[model samples]
Target: MLSWRRSTSATAPGSSLAYGCADFLGGPGARKAHVLRTVMVAAPAGLAVELLLWPVLGASFSGAPLGWGAASGAASAAAFALLHRTLAIGPMNVLSPVTALVSAALPVGVALLHGEHLGAAGLVGLPLALVAVVQVGAGHGAGVARPSRTALLLAFGAGTAIALQLIFLHQAPSDSGVAPLITGRAVSSAVTLAAAGQMHRRLGAERPAYAMSAAASVLDSLANLLFLLAARNGDLTVVAVITALYPAGAVLLARGVLAERVHRGRLIGLGTAAVAVSLLALT
Candidate 1:
């Protein structure tokens, strides 16, 4: 769960869709610690889901790649913690886009380094995707306050961490099934618990908050499971870019649930991202 201050005026458009999703999870008092705590609590539930679905999905597992999965989970936890913290403490508009761009770019770079070729369409679409991410990250309206440099750096680092997590997960063998995901959830939970302890935050006496956190955790786990499956069979570049469009879901949520106005800039960015993703798929 993540939360931040909401702007009163429509002129601001305040948080981006990513932050909007966080808002749903944590509400106005949502901060870095709360977000981490939610993730920590959700880990076990996510693991359970993976285990339950394994038999139905007919997924097989091997212990050999558990280490890789654990590593990926650790990186993912770190990324989420850092990213939520950045979002909580900084401008959502700027940080979200910066993080999204880096998250998308790194996997593509990794794919290229591994001799994965991007056809002409992919080459063109890559830049377009970057541009779209930037547009979405920038505030929805003119005259918006600029995001701090520290926030930008934090977001970038978070995105890199997420990229590493994705790359590692992609390396897992298909037969490994959701075992890596389970390993990742366990690792992330432990790390987040430690972080919560250090911060001296207690997840107590807030029933609604707990419920929201639990929901977020379940959704996040499902997302991770699906992503792992997708990356296993698809090109990492394609999967990463497509997955990076998750903020668009946040935007839609914001509009429908929060009644937030979707400005032209964001709409354009989202539309551009859709086109860019389509191009990537074709390539």
Candidate 2:
């Protein structure tokens, strides 16, 4: 009986040790799944809220070509899914700022192509924004630790997707009364759901994960609706730049909830971005 007890105790520890290693290796994949699932839940909820508010907000449905919006929504969903995946296993400090810069710059370039000239301040701000991206990409400390190539690539893709989303949203007809947004959200949700399914894993097993996912979905939908409205009435450059400041919220949340350390380089990069946004706004 004593020998059996000893053998059982030894087996338990070995099993636990194996479990720990498996958990660590699988962490990234699990996190990716969680993020995608959150998006799936959040997007549909957001769409519902937008639909409910449409009539109250006096939005009218104009017959607009929805191809661009649908395409943009699919792209955005893919980008966001990738972004969350990167953030799960990569450096948030690096990804957030780089993504923000790309998101802001692309719309500005589009605006310029459309004959929207920048003022002196905007001209100056553009360079500063680029510099900020570089600084953030260079790492957030004295040693200048850069993110993995995969992470950087993911960040770039995310930004590009955001820019496309904003640009396409602007193309929506003025009379479309939130229909484009609804269409876009639907597409995004569908894409996200497909991605989650492709993972072949269970989603939101934890209560907290479900709650956070729901909250994120509501906020994301609200943000998308606002961006559509803003882009419809304003310059795409101006609106995109304003919206790109979203990373600031994420940064703060990371600091508060995760207690992540913000090194000097990150601070400098973030500051530069703030100044650039101010100048862009002034221009």
Task: Find the candidate with the highest TM-score and give its number.
Answer: 1
lDDT of 2 by residue, 73-185 (tens): 87778677666767765676567667768877898888989988778987897678667655544445433556788888888888898788778877877666667777787
Candidate 1 CA-lDDT value: 0.69
| Deviation in Å, model 2, residue 279 alpha carbon | 2.6
lDDT of each: 0.69, 0.63
What does candidate 2 score on TM? Answer: 0.73
Task: Estimate, for each residue in 161-249, the C-alpha lDDT of model 1 and write its tens digit.
Answer: 98898888888876676777777877877888787678654665343356566666666666666676566656777667666666776
Q: Which segments of candidate 1 are over 4 A away from where they belong?
A: 1-33, 58-64, 142-144, 201-208
Model 2: lDDT of residue 83: 68
Best by lDDT: 1
TM-score of 1: 0.82
Model 1, position 265: C-alpha lDDT score: 88
